[model samples]
Target: MEEYGYLWQLALILMSTKFLGLLTKRYKMPQVVGALLAGLLLGPAVLGNLLSGVVIGGHHLENLALHQTDFIEHLSEIGVIVLMFCAGLETDINELKKCGKASFIIAVLGVIAPLIGGGAFTYWFLEEGWIEASPDSSLFIQAVFVGVVLTATSVSITVETLQEMGKLKTASGNAILGAAIIDDILGIIVLTIVTSLGGGKATAGDSAPLWLVLLKIALFFVFVAIFGYIVYKFFKWWRQRDGKGMHRHAIMAFVICLLMSFAAEYFFGVADITGAFFAGVIISMTQEDQFIASKFDVIGYMFLSPIFFASIGLKVDGDAVMSMGWTVAVFAVLLTVIAVVTKIIGCGLGAKVCGYKNYQCIRIGVGMISRGEVALIVANKGIEAGLMSSAVVAPVIIVVIVTTIVTPIVLKPVFMSGNKTASDVPTTSKLVENYEQREKIGKTNR
Candidate 1:
C-alpha cells in the first residue's frame, strides 16, 4: 500500500509536468517556464491549499504526515542534478576552443562588472539601517552575497533562444555560446571561492585552510582529466569490440557520473552540480558521448528536468514579492537593468578588445545576460547557507526570472539584423576533427 501511494505521487508529478511542458512548447516558450507554471498551479501557492482538505480529508497524505508538496520538492532536487548534467553534455568544447580569446575576455568582464555593480548596490541599499535586518551583519558580507548572485550566467536559456531564432549557427550566436560557456566555468569558480569565504572557520574560531581548498580544486581537475582519458579510451576500445551492449556502457557512464558527483560534494566541498558538470565534460570526450547523452536525455527531460523547474515556481512566495510592494518593484527594475547593461558592457568590451565588430560585441553581451538554472541554483544555495536574507533573495529571484523571460524576446531582433556572414561564425566541426586527428597521430607516434 505504501509503495502504491509513492507510485501515485510520481504519476501525478509526471502527468502535470508533461501536460504543461507540451502546452508551453505549443506557445513557443521555453519548457522550463511551462514546468514552473505547472508547479505553481498545482503547488501550495494555488491548488495545494484548495485540494488539501478534500484530498487528505483532515488526515496527512502519508503515515509520516508527508504532504504531496514535500515529495515534489525532493523530486525537484533530482531534476536539477540531471538537468545540470544534460546542460554540461550540450556544451561544445570545440566551439569554446575556437573562440577562446574572445570568450575568455567577455566572460571575465561580464563576471567582474556584475560582481562590482551588485556588490555596490547591495552595500548602498541594505547595509545600513535602511532595512530592518540585524545591525551586526557587516556590509562586506552583504556585498559578497550580492556579488555571488551576479556571478552566474545562465547560458542554457540563451542558447535555446538563439536556436529558436534560427541564429544559433551565426557569428553572434557562436560568440554568445562561447562566452556563455566560459561564463559558467568562471561563475562556478567564483561560487566556490565565495562559499569558502562564507564558511569562515574550519575549526572553532579558525578559518578553513585556503591552500587546502585550492589544492582540492586543482586535484579535482587532475582527476577529471586522467579519469576522463581512461574512460574515453575504454569506451573507444569497447565500441570496437563485438557483442558489446550499449546499455552496459550507458550504465557504466551513469555510475561514473554519480561517483564523481558524490566525490565532489563529500570530498571537495564543491557543489554537486559542478561535479556533475565536470563528469559530463569528461564523458563528452568519449566515443560513446552521443549514445550516453541520448539515454540520459530520456530520463532527464521526461522526469528530472520538469520537477526541477516546477520546484522553483513552487518555492517562490508571490505574497512576499507583493507585500514588499514598491521596494520590490523598484529593485526588480533596477537590478534587471543593471544585470543587462553590465553584461553588455562587460562582454561587449571584451569582444571589441578581441577585434570583434561593435555589433557582434553587443550581441555577445546580450546573449550572456540570460540567467537560468545555474543562477537559481546558486540563489537557492545562498538562501540555504544563510548568506542571503529574504529581501536579498526576493529581488535576485525577480531579476533571474525577468532576465530569463525577456532575453530571448530582446535578442531576436538584434541577432536577425546582424550582417555577419555564415563564414564569420566559428566552425566547431573543424576544431573537433583537428583534435581527433591530433589524438590519432599521437597514438601512432606512441
Candidate 2:
C-alpha cells in the first residue's frame, strides 16, 4: 500500500504539470513557468495544506496530498541529473571550438561579475549591521555560495526566443550558446571547489584540505578521461551492433550516467549532476549522441524535469523569507536586478572585446541573463550542503523566476526595435519579404 502511494503522487504531478504546461504555452510563456507554479500550488505553499484531507491512495491509508515532499525531492534529484546529461549530449562541441578564445573570456568575465555582485551583497548583509550574525554558518562561505549561484546560465529559454526571432544561428546567438556551455563547465569547477572546501563555519573542519581536494579534482578528471574513452568505445561497439533502438543500449548509457553520478559525489566530492553532465559530454561525439539526447530529453522533460522545477517552487518558504526582513528583501531585488544586468554587461562586454558591435553586445548580454535549471540546482545544492541560509532560498527562487520571465519580456522588443543590431539587421529586400511573412503568421504564433 505504501509503495503504491508513489504511483498516485506521480499521476497527480504529471497531470497537473501538463495542464499548466498547456496554459502557459497558450499565454506565450515557456511551459516550465507553469509547471513550477503547479508544483508550488500542489506543495505546502498553496494547495498542500488546503488539500490535506484528500485521500489519494487506493487503500486511503497514506496522506499523499498533505506531505509527499521528501519522496518528491528524490524524484527531483533524478530530474536534475537527467537534465544536465541531456544538456551535455545536446552541446555542439564544434560550436564551442568555433567561439574559440572568446568563449573562455566570456565565461571568465561572466563568472566574475556575478561573483562580485552577489558576493558583495552577501558580505554586506553579514559583515555590516544589515543582518544578524548566526554562529551556525560561515558568512564568508555563504557569501561565496551566493556568488556561485549567480554563475549559472539557462540558455534553453534564450534559444527558443532567438529561434522565434530567426536569429539562432547569428553571431550573438552562437556566442551565447558557446559561452553558456563553457560557463557550465566553469561553474561546475567553481561549485566543486566551494562544495568541497567546506560549507559554513560550523562545518569548515569537515572539508578536505586544499591539497587533498586538488588531488581529488585532478583524479576525477583523470577518471573522466579514462572512463570517457571506455564509454566512447562502447558507443562505437554498440553502433556496430546496430543497437540504435535497442533498449539495452539506452539502458547502458543510463547505467553509465548513474555510475558517473555516484562516482563524482562518493569518490570525487564533485556534484553528481556535474558527473552526469560530463558523462554526456564524453559520449556526445558519438554517432548516437542525437539518439541518446532525444530519448533522454523525452524521459527527462516529459517525466522527470517538470518535477524538479515544480519542487523548487514547492519548497520555497515565504515565512522564512519574510523573517529575513526588509534588508534581505532589498537584497533579493538587488540580486535579481544584478542577475539580469551584470550578465549583459559582463558577457556583452566580452562580446564587445571580441569586436562585436553595441547591439550584438546587448544581444549577447540579454542571452546570458536568463538563469534556469542550473541556478536552481545550485541553490538546492547550497541549501543541502548547509552553505546558504533558509533566507537565501526565497531569493534564489525569485532569481530563477524573475530572470526567466524578464529575459523574454526584455528580449522581444530589443530585437524588434528600429536600431540595427550586428547580427539581426534586415536588408531592404529581406525587410519586404519579412513584412509579407508577418502577414501570414498569427500574433499568438509569434
Candidate 3:
C-alpha cells in the first residue's frame, strides 16, 4: 500500500539529493547545496506542484511524492542531531578550550548584530506597510522576536563543509564550532527574555522568568558534566573488557545521544541538537570514540543527513511565497541581504577584535550565517503569539534558504584564499602534535 508510500518518497529524496550533491561537488561547492536544491525541486515548490491535480486509480499522485511529510521531517531532525553528535565526536576538546574566550566574543557579537539588524528591519518594514501585526501585539515584541530568529546559526551546514574540506580540525574551524555552541546558548537566553515579555504569545502558557531560564541552562550543563563523566567511565570500561570490537558499543553511544537530546528539549527548553552534540563530546573522551563516530557517520550520511538537508528545501511553500507580490519580494531580498551582511560584519568584527586574520574573520562570519529549523521555530512562536503575520513566514523561508545556500558558496573561496599564518595554524597543528605524542607515549608504556 498506500500506507507504505513513504518508501518510494524516501527513494526519491536519497537519489535526488545524492545526484545533485555530486553535481555541486564538481563546481567546488559543498554537496549541501545540491541536497538543498534537490529538495526544492522535488517538493511542492517545483516538481510537486507540477504533479498537482492528477488522479490515478482514485489515488492522488501528489500525495505520493510528499508521502508522510511529518515522518520525513522527524527523520530530518534525527539527521541534524546525528550530524552534530558526529561533530562532537571528531572535535578536539583542547582546541575548543583554547578558543573559548574568542568563541564567546564571536558569539556575543554574532547575536547582537543580527538582533539589532533584524529588529530594525522588521520595525521599518512594518512602518512601510510591508508586514502587519495584530492590534493586541506590541510592535516592539514582534520586532525583537524577528531579530531573535536571525540570531540563530545553523552550523550543521558549516560542519559538513569543513569536514569535506578536511579543515574540521583547523584552528579557524575550531573557533567556528566553539562559537556556534556559545551562539546557541546565548540565543536561547535572548529568546527566553523576548518571549517572556511577549506575554505568552510565543507559548501556550505564561513564560518562565528569566532567572528560571538561566537556571535551566546551567543545570543542563551540570547534568552534562556529571552524566558525561559517568558515561565516559562506563564506555572506557566497556572498551577495555570487549577486546573484540563489539558493535553494541556503538548502539550504546547512540542511546546516550538520544537521551541527551531528549533531556535537552524536555527538561531544559534547550535545542535537542545541543544535547546530541554534548553527548558526542562526552563519548569522545572514551577510547571508542573513533569507532562510534564511524558507525554513526554511516547511519547519518547514508540515510538521515540527505533527508535532513532535503527537508529544509521541502519547507518552501512555492505558491505562498510566489503570491507575495513585488513588495514582499523586495522585503525578502532586502531581508536576505541584511541577514547575510549583519552576520559577517558582526562575527567578523568579533573575530578581528580577537586577533584573527581578515580571511579567518570572514570564514567565521560565513560559517555562522545559515539559519534553519531554529529560525522556523522562532517564527512559529511569533505566529502563535500573534506578533507576526503568517504571511511573513514566506520571506523568512527565503532568508533561510538563501543564507544556507550562500554560506558554503562564500566559505569555500574565503577558506581557499587564505594563506595559513601562525595565528590560524598554530593551535590546530599543535593540538595534532600533542595528540600524536600522547599516543606514542602510551604505546611506549604499554
Candidate 4:
C-alpha cells in the first residue's frame, strides 16, 4: 500500500489549527494567528525537525513530518482563492466604485515606495558589504529586482484578519482590497519591466514585448466582461427557475472559480486570485451569491482554509536560517523591517493624500503590509533570469514569513482604535440612496 502519509498530516493540521485557533481567539488575537503558529510549531522550523531525530526502538518517528507537500499546497491554493471569492461576494460594488480613484493612488504609491525603499536599502547594503553579488551582475539591477520583490502585497491574510474583526465592509477594508488588487497588477508590470532588462533572458513573461503583455492584460478584462455577463445571466436564470439553496449552484460556483483562476495564470499572466475575486464579484450581482457564499464558507472553513494558513508556516526552513550564518541572519532581520515599514509609509501617504482620516490611513497601511508568496514568486523569477542570486531566497523567505505573521497582529488593533464614519462607509440604506444619486448624476452628465 502506498503510505497513507497525507491522511495523518491532514489530521494533525486540522486538530492543531483548531486548538491553536481557539487559543488565540481567547487572547483577543485573530484565530488566524494561532493557525500560523501551529504551522510554525509543526513545520521544519520547530517540532518537525525536533521529532525527525527521535526513534522509539528502531522505527524512525514520522508523525510530525508535516513538511509541506504538493497535495497540501494545492488545497491551500484553493483555500485562498475561495477566501477571496467570498470577499468579492460580500463587496458592495457601489462602495468599491466610490473608492476606485483612491485605490489606484494608494496602489501606485504603495508599489513605488517599496520599490524605492528596497532598492535604496539593497544598494546601500551592497555598498556596506552586506550582499555578495554574482560575477558581472549589475548591483543597480539587483537592487531594482529586490525593490520589485518588496512591491508585492498578499492580501489573503489581510482579508482573513478583516473578516474576523467584521471590518471587511468598512472603508479601510475596501481600500486595502482595492489597492491590493491594483498593487498586484502594478507589481506584475514592474516585474516584467525589471526582468526584461536582464541580459537577453526571459524572466517570467519578459519574453513578450511590453505592449503585448499589456494588451493581454487588457484582453483579460474583456474576457471577464464577456464571461462575467454570461455568468450573471445564467445564475439569475437558474435562481429564478429553481429558487435557492440548491447544491448544484454551489458546485457550479466552484467550477466558475477554478475556470477563472486557470485562465488568469495560464492565458493572461495575472494572479489566479484576481480571476477568482472577479468571479465572485460577478456572482455577487446574482441572487444566489449569498447562498453560494454560505455553502462555500463551510467548505473553506472546515478543510481548505486551515491547510492554506498552515502551509505558509510550513515553508519556513529553520536549517537555512541557521546555516546562512549571523551576517546573513542580520540581513534577513533588517530586510524584514524594511519590508514592513516601507509598505506602511508608502501606502499611508497615499491614503492621506486621498483625504482619509489619519487613523484610516494607518489601518490601510498596516493592512497592506503582508507580502506573502507574491514576493517570493518575484524573487524566484529574478533568480531564474540571472538578475538575482540563489542566496537572496533565504532572506526573502524570512521576509515573507515575518510580514505574513505581522500584518494581522498589527491590523486588528489599528482597526479597533478607530471608529468608522458614515462618510467613510455608507450605511446599507444610504447605499441605495447614494446609488440613485450617482445614477441621476450620470444621467445629467450624459
* Model 2 / residue 429 / CA error / Å: 21
lDDT of 3 at 356: 89
Which ten contiguous residues of candidate 4 have the minimum total lDDT? 426-435
lDDT (CA) per prediction: 0.68, 0.75, 0.76, 0.75
Please write out the lDDT profile of model 1 over residues 341-376, one tens digit for every residue. Answer: 887888889889988887778788888887766776
Q: At residue 317, what lDDT does model 3 achieve?
A: 65
Q: Estimate each model's TM-score.
A: 0.80, 0.85, 0.74, 0.71
Worst 10 residues of 1 by lDDT: 129-138
Error of 4 at 348 (Å): 3.5
Go through the candidates in order and give the clash count of each: 1, 1, 1, 0
Checking candidate 1 for backbone clashes, the offending pairs are 79-304
As for candidate 2, its clashing pairs are 138-201
The local lDDT score (0 to 100) that residue 151 gets in candidate 3 is 94
Off by over 4 Å in 3: 54-61, 100-104, 123-203, 355-428, 431-446
Task: Write one digit per residue (lDDT tens) for candidate 2, span 1-446.
Answer: 76777777778888888899889788666677777777677766566555545665543422434244678889888988888887677555654666578767888889888988888887888787565433556788788888999989987678778778877666666677778878988888898888777545425557667899889888999999999988888778877978547666667788888999999988988778889988888868777665566567678767898888777777665455556679777878988998887888889888888887787778788889988778888887777677776667667777887888888888877666535545564323322233234324322232
Which segments of model 4 are wrong by more than 4 Å? 100-104, 119-206, 355-446
> By lDDT, highest first, what's the ranking?
3, 2, 4, 1
Query: Whose TM-score is greatest here?
Result: 2
